[model samples]
Target: MMDRTDRHCRYFLRQISARTLLYTEMVTSQAILHGDLEKLLGFTPEESLIALQVGGDDPARLAKCATIAAEFGYDEINLNVGCPSQRVQSGNFGACLMMEPERVADCVAAMRSASNLPVTVKHRIGVDDHDHYEHLRQFVEIVAAAGCQRFTVHARKAWLKGLSPKENRDVPPLRYADVYRLKQEFPDLVIEINGGILTLDATLEHLAQVDAVMIGRAAYDNPYLLAEADRRIFREAVAVRSRHEIVEAMYPYID
Candidate 1:
């Protein structure tokens, strides 16, 4: 769970599923390097599987922050190259970074070399008006060659100048077909699809086409949906817990 604005949500979620992976809201590299590192990423270890989502174009700063995240005991480190926020764009990161695959590759390589934990990337298909399957293919190709194998693609293009971040997630149409094709082209790579995947059925459908499905809004809104997620998708032997029971189970730990 990343990009969420509420700390209450994180506390509630940690109460629900200790086995599920969790992510912090995207923190810029400058925040980690120049700002307060302890305050930005501080959390309890019992918050389940945690990953830090970083935003920045500078490779050295990004790597240094990744090392800090590792020292903070983050299970994995993810780079956010998919956000369409104008503020993020002005910072020369986010969706705009997708236009520079070589730079993204270098950023990933630096992060990977800095820490022992897994380095992953979450990106958009394309940015602004440059929406094309080939463009996404090239971006993935170069990044994969740079030693970052895990990718989560938001199946949409980001119109940098027009859409607001909220509108970017909704207004622009989602193009899931391109993501499926990318998976077919790079079967060796671990490909996960994001954007507009709301229901368990939708995730199932996408999983048939890609290696994994990443849920954001849906997972946060209808959290009960995850009741069936682990058993069905991850093939865990544990039975799905009722949402009410999940809450109760987590209450004691959080208290």
Candidate 2:
């Protein structure tokens, strides 16, 4: 959600569902450390239940980024290990890091210790020929041991060799069963499944098997999909606001 879930988009979504958790586009740890912090990390208090997602391989820089994120009032810090973009791969992070569980462990531990905030990881099930249950389990165990209790898995193995990033999202068959099995084995950890989930009903169905569901393109493509999220997903009794009211509400923010 690099350019998709920006502050403006989040504010729009907030007017729809106050309870839905939102995340920032992945900001590089180096960017947070040296770039314009406000532009990179700024968000409104109204955007509660929000998380800051960072991408990088340096444990020290990520740890620093975590501390900065906490000070900026983010509810969670998410490490990206699921993205298959060539840009991310060249940086030595993203889906490629699945091959280095211990290194991921070190980065997680460093971030956790730095901010003392809730740390989560988003990763694919596997990479290259390493797509196996044991491979996923080992990766999860190592990171979990480093105190990352929550993992958002993009239920597909990332093919780093031939597939382009766009193809990656569609090419690799979604092995949701693999994610379901993960939740079964590690019942104590929070396992949230991602990848192609498009409806509130589908989200609810996945919740029956896992702890949570993360919707990306689906939600962004048709944000009205979130209008009933509070009442339907969170079970809040608040009245559902109409589309006209939402559009009127967003006019000022859009300006």
Candidate 3:
């Protein structure tokens, strides 16, 4: 969802579902700290309830990024511990951070201290040899103890060595059961499941067991799939927009 969920893509999807919580693509703490501030953190007030997902292993820098996100009016701050790319691993962040849950906890605690926005973590179920439910559970507990109340868990383990980032997304089998069980045990926390959920019916099915479902590439690939999301997912009575109407609606923004 890197290049896929940029500002233009998110703006287009926003026309489809006014109520769904749209997410910005992962922007590393380094980028937010040193790169173009407005380009990295800016969004219209129309994009309310949106979350800015940041990547990094540095507690101080992530805390600074969290403060910026709050000043920029992001409703939530998400720490990315799910990308399995070599660049991410070399940077000592992303999926590699999952192995060091205590560090993830420290980063979470630091961010929460710096801002009032909700601090959350999006992580893989497991990684490489740590692909077991107990390890996943332990990782969640340690991080949750640090005050991360919501977690968007990708239901696959990451292979830091064997696969390309694109292949890593598909080749690893999704173990949604691990996510469901995480909810069962930690019923108090908000557990949103992500990975391979492509259809509304599939979304409903996951919602039966988990608190929420996150559709990434599936929603981005055919954004219209969320045309009825406000009605179906949020129980709003809004009419679904037709393809033509949706495009026409986007004209002003395109200008």
Candidate 4:
């Protein structure tokens, strides 16, 4: 979701579903700490219930970014430990950090201390050869111990060595069962499953197993699928807008 869920894309998704919580692209801690703040973090008020995802392993910088996110009115701050791109690994963050649970814990703890907003972690189930349920459980427990209550688990293992980022998404077989078992073990934790969730039916089905379902690529590519989200997921009594009406609403922004 790094390049895909930018401000404009979020706005478009917002037009389709008013209730589904949206997340911004993964902005690294260094960017928020050193780069132009507004350019990196700015968003309109309409994008409420949006969470800002930050990528980094430095506790202090991550804390600063989380504070900035809180000041900018983000509903939550999510730490990204799921991305498998080489650029991310080079920074000692992303899925690579799964090997260093204590460091991730420190980062989460620092962010929690810096901001009153909810601090969450988005991570893959496992990484490379360590694709076991026990490994994932330990990772989740350690990070959750740092007061990160919510975890969005991408249901795939990341091969940091050979596969490209796109291949990592496709090649690593998604083991959604591991995520479900995580929920079963840590019943108190808020576990949301991500990866390969396409249709509304699949989302609803996953919801039965976990607290939430995160739709990534499918949500961006065939965005119209989210049109039914409010009524079907949230069960809101409000009338759903037609696709044409949604496009009309977006015209001003496009102009």
**Which residue pairs come into collision in candidate 4?**
none
CA RMSD per model (angstroms) = 1.8, 0.9, 0.7, 0.8
Error of 2 at 9 (Å): 0.7
Better of 1 and 2 by lDDT: 2
TM-scores of all candidate predictions against the true structure: 0.93, 0.98, 0.99, 0.98
* lDDT per residue (tens digit) for residues 1-255 in model 1: 444734456666765555666778999999999887677888776675877889999999999988999999989999999998889989999989988999999999999999998998999989876788989999999999988888999998988887888898998889999999999999999999999988888888998999888888887987776777667777777766777777787667568
Span of 10 residues, lowest total lDDT, candidate 1: 1-10
lDDT string, candidate 2, 1-255, tens digits: 988999998999999989999999999988899899999899989888899999999999999999999999999999999888888999999999999999999999999999978999999999999989899999999999999999999999999879998899998999999999999999999999999999999999998999999999999999999989899888899999999999998887778
What's model 1's lDDT at 207? 84
Question: What's the CA error at residue 127 for candidate 1, in Å?
Answer: 1.3
For model 4, residues 1-255, the per-residue Cα lDDT tens digits are 877888899899899999999999899999998899888889998878899999999999999998899999999999999999999999999999999999999999999999899999999989988878999999999998999999999999999999999998898898999999999999999999999999999999999999999999998889999999999999898788899999999999899
Best-to-worst order by lDDT is 2, 3, 4, 1
Q: Residue 155 of model 3: what lDDT?
A: 98
- In candidate 4 the C-alpha lDDT for residue 224 amounts to 94
Compare the candidates by lDDT and give the number of the best one. Answer: 2
- lDDT measured at residue 165 in model 4 versus the true structure, 0 to 100: 93
Say which prediction, candidate 1 or candidate 3, comes out ahead on TM-score. 3
